[model samples]
Target: MAGGITEMGEPYSPYVGLVYMFNLIVGTGALTMPKAFATAGWAVSLALICILAFMSYMTTTFVIEAMAAANAQLRWKRREQEAVKDSDSSDYSDDEVIVRGRSEPLEARPILSVQRGGSSPDQFDIVERVEMGQMASLFFNKVGVNMFYICLIVYLYGDLAIYAAAVPMSLMEVACGNHSCSAGSVKYNDTDLCWGSVKRKDAYRVFLTIFTLLLGPFTFFNAQKTKYLQILTSVMRWIAFSMMIILALIRIGKGEGQGRPPAASFSGIPNLFGVCVYSFMCQHSLPSLVTPISDKRRVGRLVLADYALILAFYSLLSFTAIFCFAGGDLRDMYTLTFTDSCHALDAAPLRYFLGLFPVFTISTNFPIIAVTLRNNWKSLFHRDGGTYPWVVDRVAFPLITLVPPVVVAFCTHNLESLVGITGAYAGTGIQYIVPASLVLLSRRHLEPALGRGAVNKHRSPFRHTFWVGFVLAWATFCLMFVTANIVLTETKPKN
Candidate 1:
């Protein structure tokens, strides 16, 4: 089948999707995992990360299933409209042909389900591109859609905030802080002066201003991260990762390793959960990523394989860092470890390269993410067939997208807390709860029309109702646990 690959020019091979997913799932969040890993204890971090990865994978399948269902929903809705407009041209055979060719067949034959029988022809047929917002409209009630928008908005805002803070923090660390590998173990306070008179906090704020001035305006225009840019980012990411992993391995081989992470630390599990969930996040973009694959009959298997590779990759990357650097020695930004004291490496150029990795990568992504948030804002307020006012479209939307994150970044440059908060709450909603609910409701909405036996070609592996309940329940518990942890930690007396 030609499917929905036409608009995107040439579709990529299945392996390309594998690579795209890996890159998407392993971003800034991975940089923070080692610290959480060290703090939480190696054993806890390892076990928890594995469990979270599995949970995230499960929800990811939920999203893909929902995306296919959404596509079917859109396809049938359009047909309904067409049928109304051309009532006189209706033919009974046309309905059957469309049903047989495009609609979910009356019996579900999941591609991954263990079956000895032949598969249905239309089982893999919902090939239209349906974004999460469009799916919300089709599947969720008004309140549910609004809640989704709000949750997504919060998540996007947190993302932009984290990005806005990260670039400047890296710049400030590079420009004003001590670079002598000797004092790498000591923590620097924000009140410390830079350039003789400028405080480190002030330096961070200055860089944030510069960051906003330079990249913030991209939010005003409609933009897409091109394939070339993605490739470039991916290359840089691998180079940076390889550099750190190799450096750490060399240090450990030389008996110079500083880290002795404990086997398990219960206290550190919460932050690790947030960071891992954030790192594994790719569900929100599933519709865009999955729909354009050249061959998707095995999309579920493809995603499962991707998640497996990603889990192994993350474990390798984080474990290497935690062992190479002491728990207290690891910085929230893992790149800072290489920069703090470059004596570990003799090459000055390589030292600078490691220190500034986040600056380059995060800077590139900041604008792209800002534009995504801006688009989400527009979608939330959007009316059908309605055009936005000049101020609302051009000015207000971009401002809304660009400001909150900047303000949050301005107040603090703590990358760990920012990532933690974003992932724990908004990330939970987007990655877990929303996907589960969407699939459940989509199944319900689709069943009456497609019938009880209808098979969603892309239905989640957890096709049972209990799995949806489990996901939602887990999300709720995480939210409560994270919230309680934050409150207790903040309110406790300092000894």
Candidate 2:
């Protein structure tokens, strides 16, 4: 549940692997993209999205390669222990046990890759259940592992916060939003009364309370979406995305697109950068996706195709949205824009369906993510074979996982900055810096064992040392840029 080995569900085929990756990569982040694209300009958004997709794909391959390397090292250690016992060369049992107890030596290599006594066909298998967090413990020093966990925990908290705010925000809008198909009515604000003296913000807090009561308990235990539920959510996701795109296209084709987005907007680039980063994020879950492939040979190629499809889908969705509605008219939750009785859509029932899309989809997701965060917290604090007491396990973790995000939602349901900051800082670390570091360190560890010429079947296309450095450098620059932008925005006087 820590984005590690997904043992809760049954194994699936590579075809399912492709679909699962598509679903994982295309998430709530896409909902925020139309507004970001509208802000930054279509051309700028297109180029950055493409480049970031390529960058993400490259890092994905890096992680797979590292997974394979990790498998090889594990295999090598087992083989070494077997040899020591079989040969009876010396009374070195004490030494062997010590070495075996430690994490596999960095330079350990599979016997097959060593070109000697190849007894196992699965020597270089990339499908092993080496989760990202486990890999960090194996390869990274204590500080690195702690830092990785810190970044991941922070990212998951941000995730829960986004979900907490989103579902309630959607509910607040659908319940209190104007539904009379009134033309040219200004959008509702939190200051508006949801009831007699009950402000929209209070309504949001009400829904947030309901959300917590319904879903928060799942955080106390292990929770996984059953196979049927996954199928249902996937179907709902497709319907929501496709409906938005098709409706927008219909409006534009009828010669009513109101958007005249600028060709470029420098001021908008920072947020757009963060949005694209968030949208393309799937690296944290790569092990769970790549580990179950029925056929490992073409995993890289299949991921490339998936990314291409996702990029095209995002472009189509956002382009149609920006053109169908004026940029200034777009909603942070893109579905809300279509939910009102506006010029773009006026069918009452369809409006309710669209307005409630986030409420349904995000509701399904909130538990799974909260459990994931809870598990990550456990993983961070866990010691060797040590378990938490019942009270700590059931009470403390769930409360810690559930409370802060709900607090944030109660304070404000605005998600633009929440999404942007999460993506720019924690998402960047998980997606860009972590993968680059893993592959680089894995390669260095393997050089002595596999020899410089040994070929890794799962090697990244951008396998050169130069590319690794480039990825790290680019990630650093982006982090700095985001930080500076945030600082300036905070300090700048209101105009």
Candidate 3:
């Protein structure tokens, strides 16, 4: 019976689950953080990041509580079906009863009474895996669900675009940059010659073409990363992260650090906000990671520890980077900072490895994101029992998923602005608004089934309604700030 509750995947211990959450939160966004930090000033960036981390953690708890609520709702409904079947077999013997001269059906009573009536907290156990989207559907109206998918689709598109540009940009740098370590720390322009006649941008396009040909087809089918590939990528990610941090610290220690960032820069705040939000994003995927934990009684503690570790890691990486490289010299991708011929790193092979790191990692991720986006598109338009045409399912959905991001990548390779905008708007909806709304609505939805006195053992420490409002308000402020910054910056004179 217990196995029947959580059969979606194999469950692991809470400690292993902690590692998975850590890895999920610290990905490509961390690579972009240093640049944002340098531009925004380390002091301001630190303050904003700390605040955002707390807010993100609050929302993370919200999502987890909602998941438990979702699980409880699912279990209660399943039991209701069982009860109905049994009642039908007994010729409706227990279907109704009289309460104070009013007739009531047996199912009308609190179905979750037994579990919640006890002190064991079994009712709110996260025994089932309910995805964010499923929770949205369960707790939101049709309009709200549509809006949720739209925000998610847009965020995924931005992710695809970032991955699309990053790989080719990495390849172009490794292929076109001077290999003898003789260029002496000069940035290349798009029009610069990669070879005899091909421009660097042209080389980027060529690699993009090759990338599309190889990885784009996976979107048309159900594609997943194998366990071995997951391990390989994880190992490479740690190796690359450790190498960059160590190299940066070595340069800073030698008194060769080229950075003297200002204490604050208001202009850089919006992008920094977006980057921080994006970096701390694990809310949407929490259901998958948390539901598989064999013992979830301490899941909240596990989440706190994971967030603390990630916050420390981000601060370390960004601080080392901002101190090691000059603000102007900082590349949008932090890994690119080590690719140049500089005092910090003199080895040509290591330089090339760092230069091409994104190519290896982002390429592996593009297909998975593309497939995810494709599925979201299907889910958005799916009818209750209707199937799509073969052409639409295989061709149209994949084409829509693969083309827009590639085109966006081709039009501009400004990874910083891309991430900033995506994280500010769509990421805001996912990280803040959606979770807050879900938790609030889920509580309301569960009240009828499990009286107002019922408690969700997995409820957030911020179980107060005020915290939900605070998160929503903060999200609103971030969106407005980011949008205004973009407008003012764009309209400012370009002399």
TM-score of each: 0.89, 0.92, 0.94
Stretches off by above 4 angstroms in model 1 are 1-9, 89-124, 178-187
Write one digit per residue (lDDT tens) for candidate 1, span 179-272. Answer: 6555543467789887879998999999999999999878888667777887887888899998888888889899888889999887777788
Please tell me which predicted candidate would have the highest TM-score against the true structure: 3
Task: Tell me the tens digit of each residue's lDDT in model 3 across 247-325.
Answer: 8888888888998888899999999988888899888888778888898888889899998999999999999999988
**What 10-residue stretch in candidate 2 is worst by lDDT?**
91-100
Local lDDT at 208 for model 3: 88
| Most accurate candidate by lDDT | 3
lDDT value for model 3: 0.86
lDDT of each: 0.79, 0.82, 0.86
After TM-score superposition, the amount by which residue 390's alpha carbon in candidate 3 deviates from its true location, in angstroms, is: 1.0
Arrange candidates by lDDT, highest first: which order?
Answer: 3, 2, 1
Q: What is the C-alpha RMSD of each candidate to the true structure, in Å?
A: 5.9, 3.9, 3.0
Identify the superior model by TM-score, candidate 2 or candidate 3.
Answer: 3
In model 3, which runs have C-alpha deviations exceeding 4 angstroms?
1-6, 93-120
